[model samples]
Target: MGCGPSQARVLSQAPISSNPDEFFPYQGSGPWHTSRADSVMQPRLAKSGPASSEDCPPVTLQELLKKAAEEKGDKLALKVERPCPSLGSDGGAPPAFPDEEWKAWTYREYYDESRQAARGFMKLGFEAFDTLAIWGFNTPEWLLSALAAGFAGGKVGGLYPTDTPETAAFKIVHSGASVVVIEDKAKLERLIPALAQRGEATTRIKAFVAYGFEPEAQQSVEVKGSAKPVLSWSQLMTMGKEAKDSVTESSADPLELRLKAVEPGHCAVLVYTSGTTGEPKAVMLSHDCMVFETRTVLNLARAHMGLCAQAEQERVLSYLPLSHVAGAMVDICFPFVATATTPAWVTIYCARPYDLKVGSLGDRLRIARPTIFLGVPLVWEKVADKLRAIGAANSGLKKKLGNWAKSKGLKNSKARLMGGDGAAPFAYGLANKVILSKVKAKLGLDCVKFGATGAAPIRVDTLQYFGSLGITINEVYGMSESCAACTVSTDQAHLWGSCGFQLPGVEVKAFKVDPADISKKEECPRAPSMDDLGEEYQGELCFRGRSIMMGYLGQPDLGADHVREIERKTAETIDTEGWLHSGDKGMITKHGMVKITGRYKELIIGAGGENIAPVPIEDHIKACCDGVNEVMMIGDKRKYNVALITLKAVGANGETPGTDQLDAGARRINPNVSKISEALRDDVWIQEVTAAVKSANENGKVCPNNAFKIQKFMILPTNFSEEQGFLTPTKKLKRPIVENAFKKQIDMMYSSSETYVRYED
Candidate 1:
């Protein structure tokens, strides 16, 4: 997402609305209100900055859509490659990428569709302030449902497509949603049974709408307790159109009235946290919060890329899970914000659900060729691996030339990070022209002007790998609570490992705290007059900005106990003073960049009473060893820390772990035995990994003290997969789950004194 057309303001203080709730009258016990409403959603101005939330032209998603429709009516807003069942073989999966039919929707058409959907929702018994929970993959229907829910004056939430039937039902029940949108008939069938099993939760549902299916594919799936049949996408649209036409000119349309009643301070979206530690909490984000974040992110684009002013259209690929804040912001909010508030407009291309995987994504990228790209660390790693395999196939002189160019590109990239914009070598231009440009073109990233990586910590090797090929992957840091806009790395300002500087108008500080008692804050950690790389100020990173979430969703009507629990959870993250304490431990550099160290909760305390952050140490090992795909430290109560390592392998579907075949780079090391199961017994493979671990331990950059070094290591038979519940949907390692699953292997490594231990078959 890029900045809009608003001029940069030079105000000393953030613009604050005197009466925040003046626009919307408070309704009693509704989905729009969260626990601690009096304090949670209060308007908080930035301590100091030029950007202000009030500067955003539109206050709500509905308003933003309307503005875009009025101004950019003829501009392409969305594009989708619809799967063709006719071209499928034997009633299996849809047609291949080449045979898929593409469709485009203009800004005006997008708005109209949303408006009609909103009317249909009202016709289906949806009321003002009701919740609409969308459970689907990233598609045109998902976006439309979310917008329509907002347009109909309702709070919108999403359930990850990866969520199980139970998890989906839990979110629907928790949100008190009157309607749920499923991607297709099969998923709808699975969900209806789960909802029916829930005694009270099932009663809340009024309708189940299914999209991405033909009318004939829509089955008579119904909850056991109820007789309501599943509504098809076309049926919903027809209902909406009839409702719209029924409204005479003399009478006010109910949908229009709902839209008019929408307010800036009202809750617009509910973003659920990953819930790694406990049950997921629904984070309440106000319309004001979303608008502010959209503007701030866009402003950064204007500052760095000079976007909005340009005539060229920004092309963005919408592939990430729409349930996540990062995904929703980039794909949904960013485009609308750009269209409404800035001269720049974005055309979004919807990707298939499986497009996040390594092999399948390339086909979609070739079609979309997005100008803006953002991916999680795993996504970036896959792309790097794909490129590596391609390079490994080149022979003789071509290989030599490619390696030479990569060296120059890598050097120039590193220099650029050190503020060496004009320090490129004489041969750098030639390298870009002769090799790097062609590589980017082949990968369909030639059109990408801006690229970023977030969600989890990325490997330095992955960054350098992309840098070597003339692509800079800027790291961004934010969570659901911050509306996914806090700090970002841009071309103008960036650090090697840091998450980059704080966004304009977003204030960030490192507050001092006791490691044993993180809640006991003492004072602000100060970074005095220091050098360029000085990181003297180390503490918990806290953020304060308009983009901060309102509060976690609370069921006030449920009981006093439920309300108290919600308040307790909300208070743990946000303080009375309004600083949202990110559980992450990091520091502010003298240069004002934010560098994350590790999670406070994830810190490992060894038996020797030394506290250590495992992420850096684990990342170091992965960086030193190209074959390793995952690493976990296991010495929370042991004498020394040990690592559980899994080698990269060829996937059956570019996602799930399948064959025992070792990945390309790993196979090169032990060509005699390509399978991981056999490679563990190979002397060459074992020795290489042992040497890599030793190098990682001796690297002071990651392991500052001797205790932090991994004393021993064990190789797992398989990589962590989502199917095994070892990895989250976003591809982050589930530390507790992994530890529990591999307890026996971890125990064996500690019991043995060998430097390299093998997992028992």
Candidate 2:
């Protein structure tokens, strides 16, 4: 998703409005509304300098650092993006939303804190060869741990906060970390029993540092260990403060201690990627590689989607786990990179801030009137739910009428459904003005220039709803193995259903398709490759660039299995030599853009001779019905498809859709979630989705048994979760785990139609 075309202005300071654009500082410098018909994308951010490539010598990240050091020694590096951390219960939940007045650190302050944390770890006996394990949700402290560890010349292992106790302890022991940073005492308590079971491994942790602690924490951390606990977040920064104090009027830079400690090519981060078999393997990324990849992200065409500092307003609401590459890149690397050297040039207003939380995390996103926002698909889905709920709360008829009008391309209009239009849907802007707009006002996301949806494909309808609200949906595409920078749909050429062009500095080409399997890759269903016709070409996507990772850590066997030099062929084509084999299968479009279809390993092999990719079914089915939150098609080796569905709750969005004479204005099950859920379970649409998934797979070879498409499925009361071991950290369900966990429910689905059935939008 990218920004759609820019539209004309309609200004109003008040949050409530007929025109959605008015909430934007339309009266301010930027235009408010954008044209619906415009090409999809947010307004492009103003150039940071001349084009980043404008410099003749060309500015690599290393070169930019060199320039920043020489010209702006005393300037900021990284700082707290908020005024101060909100210390509260449930891991700082209530105050996670946006605030206009808050403390944000300057680059100098951030650098100082990181250096101090590095020194503090050092003081506690951590050294270059030692490892410090950090397990926590995303927060300033999480960022500090990674940065400080890197600066101190030590490698860090980021264990997910929600990891099973066994898994947590295993990763800790595996990384050989001598120190551990805990977010709070509750997590520490959970770790103690598991650690105790590991004997020598858990005892090796010499010190524990707690982040986001409440006053009731002291008694909870008493485990049977000699290791001391520390709760000096405020006191720990004295080193930086003291260093600042020691500086004289004519003193050299006070952050010299922090600067000289960093070294590239050292072990920077250890991120774990689960394998097709056995346990998860650690991917070791070098400092040089990590920094360069982050820079590649900075160079992406979609960077303009963020809130610009120039808007006199800017903010980032962060909730992604800092342990993962995406979180670390955004919170620790991207923010530092963006704000560092050009502090004077960027004037981002501080508003939205994310506080640490377990289970679910959300915040008010205060953005520059024209700003960039990046989030995974789940975030947008939630936003859509909120909008529908709000709009439906008012007169259902009026809301329907309003939505219908808005659908007809009217921005804001008044419609009274005192009688007629009762059967129609709400006006288009109806949801925008009445429902989503209020949510945006509360979250302060009304001014967002554009936002990115990635880590998974987002339903186009979700993007469309946000578009109606005046926020552009910018789609992003990438994989963790590729340093998380890959094909992001740029403002131009952002075609629906395809990831945009290959990014600059990266060259993508399809080399070969197993001619025996050429029919599988054919566009017209098993047609031959030709000129005005086709030339069958497709396979595992191969990528070569600085952004590629340094390979799996300590797992040379795995590295040998996949990593290779770039491929270079007979026709000066590719160096067809050795290219890193990305596990995904894809085809090159006529425009030279790479279109990935599915994972080679995850393809379902059916007993009745149907090949399927569950994702496409999940995507299409979930889209066909508003009731289903997530759909996972199981039955990989079985005779047919079976699904495990998580319902989108009734009254979760827009007054449960319809209200009949039964006084069902806001009833939960009438047009209830279950009823709606059953409607989507309609056999016709199910068959259609099954066929679509099949078509996307082996290129449209329908199996003989239509009834076997999806004989039966269990509707789940709750969605899968990482902590529950039903899903991976990235939100992809763990197939085996999910099947085992829901075995009883699955049995019921097949043995009987116990799950309710009905139909409603």
Best by lDDT: 1
How accurate locally is residue 90 in candidate 2, as Cα lDDT from 0 to 100? 47
Off by over 4 Å in 2: 1-101, 201-204, 214-231, 238-262, 274-278, 302-314, 341-363, 366-370, 393-401, 404-443, 509-538, 555-578, 650-669, 672-708, 744-761
Model 1 Cα shift for residue 731 (angstroms): 1.3
For model 2, give the 10-residue run with minimal summed lDDT. Answer: 565-574
Candidate 1 yields a Cα-based lDDT of: 0.76
lDDT of candidate 2 over 1-761, digit per residue (tens): 12222332221110111232211111232221111111111211112221122311222232233444444445433323343455466444444423334444444545456667766676566656456788876556776677677665667788875677778877776566766887766677788778777664455566667765642444334334564556455544554456556668787642454345444544567776643334665555555555655555454432433332231223445566666777656655565445433332122222222322221233434333224567677667866665566566757787775465445322321111111121323454455666555555554566555457776667756766665554556665666655565565543334344454454444343445343432122221221211111324445565544344444444212233322211111111112232345556566554444555566667677786554656655666565554456777677777556777665543221112221111122122234323433435545434443444444233232223463355555555445555456666666657777777677766656566532322211
lDDT of 1 by residue, 100-205 (tens): 3578899999999999999888887788777889998888889999999988888888998888888888788878788888886777778877877666646667
- For each candidate, C-alpha RMSD in Å? 5.1, 12.5
- List the candidates' TM-scores in order: 0.91, 0.70
lDDT of each: 0.76, 0.49
> TM-score of predicted model 2?
0.70
